[model samples]
Target: MLSENKLWYQNSRMEETKALLLQARQEGFRSIRLNLFPAAVAEGGVDAIDAWYQSLRVLVTYGNSVGLHMIIDLHESNRCGVDASECRRLTTDFWSRTAGMFSDTRFDVSYELLNEPKGEMVSQWGALYPQLIKLVRSKDRHHSIIVGGKGYSTIWDLPPADPDQERIIYTFHYYNPMSFTHQGADWLKAHPSLAERRNIGWGSYADRTRLAIDFRSVDGWRSRNDAPLFLGEFGVFKRAPAEDRVVWLSSVARMSEERGITWCLFDYEGGFGVEGLLPAIQKGARRQP
Candidate 1:
């Protein structure tokens, strides 16, 4: 999957998005994940949201025409989690309308209920997700529903596979040893020192062993429940040592494939993007499905 981020949602960038979809398809990406903010798209009311999805239909249609599957990710975070009753209600309502709107489309689409549920919300994601899943299933049972655990979808916190839901796929984001992957990342206020950190190599035997152990555990979980798994996000920041970043990405991606897991790179264009799509991707860091 190629994460185009907000570029695909901006009304002014529709033509640009079309070109991107075509580019991704040509480069062998089978799908694209659209990070969507429903509330931001239609703030006035439900009617506004309905209109917004009508616009989305055009994008989805174009994406499918190019042989790219679509992952409709609800990229909201503030309004989810525990005790946010009003927020929860509004989120639920969005999915209801969203599910209803896309249920009949012939194109391949997957609904990611929410992106990176954090803090208190992560603590109760197991409980919250099933409710949303039930709501979504009521409207659209044909398409797969993707979900993840708390701690921002960390593998260690992955929720147990649900035996009751066959069409559901569990997801996790891997940015382990964040000191390496997130080095020089300014947005991490809690770790301001990372801004100056660089050249953090990550290919020690211990590091490789730890990665294998983590992925194998997830593979075991999938086997136990007969469920599918998706490594929805994984990438190294641009400032990391170039060779080390490539090794890490290649290792993680290849490991996911060895375990029969599908993955989406963290981004196509961003601070953690696969710039030029040549060095890392062509060097065996990425494999097309």
Candidate 2:
């Protein structure tokens, strides 16, 4: 992020994104998800945003060249939805101005409406989602849009999407058994209870049972939502024990595959690599119906 120039995306950082995407492809992944932090309206007008998009176009072009589809996520807009007026004012405008910007771009770039709608945003999502859907559908029909449930896109209680819309995929982030997955995560530990959740063991019966219950919720949501679902983000932090992290990852991977829901790991080099796409995972996923 080059804040000095006010462009959220910089060419240098894009190099890293590109390198990660290439590494993902080499490891048998075909698509990458990129997060975006939209500069505030106070920052600039259409000209400024157009400049930002121009920089982004270069990166998407490279992604297309390498046979990858990129998902552009609105990383931090969930909070805006708390104030109905602000949510309507900012989100609709954001999508309206930029959704068409990439229509003619040479790559497949999908728009993700919001990152993780927490607190008021979750309960109020139904009030906001349909409007954004209408706004984006009008601008660009060629690209797909990804949306997620509340509770930070948790798998429980997925809100059903309108039936009229097409190419709208549901997404969720997995950090189940937060005690185990988020162990040693500084941000998560700010609350005293989470601070004490570190060093939880994996591969226990309780751990497996928790996995089963969480995935069952996901399965129920899949059956109810009637739209394509995506496992948007799921990873165990690097601070956790390596064997436990792998166990958690393999469990989630198996559940997603068994149900035929596609997914993306949280990151490549950051943490939770699953032994760099172990062949056992690939072969197991292939054998699933």
RMSD of 1: 2.9
Query: TM-scores of all models?
Result: 0.89, 0.85
TM-score of 2: 0.85
**Candidate 1, residue 166: lDDT:** 66
Report the C-alpha lDDT of model 1 over 72-157, residue by residue, as the tens digit: 88877655644456547766987898888788859689999888887567666777889999999999989999998875887876
Candidate 2 lDDT, tens digit per residue, 210-255? 8888899877776666788889988887777776776677778888
The deviation in Å at residue 101 for candidate 1 is 1.4
* Top TM-score prediction, candidate number: 1
Could you say which candidate leads in lDDT? 1
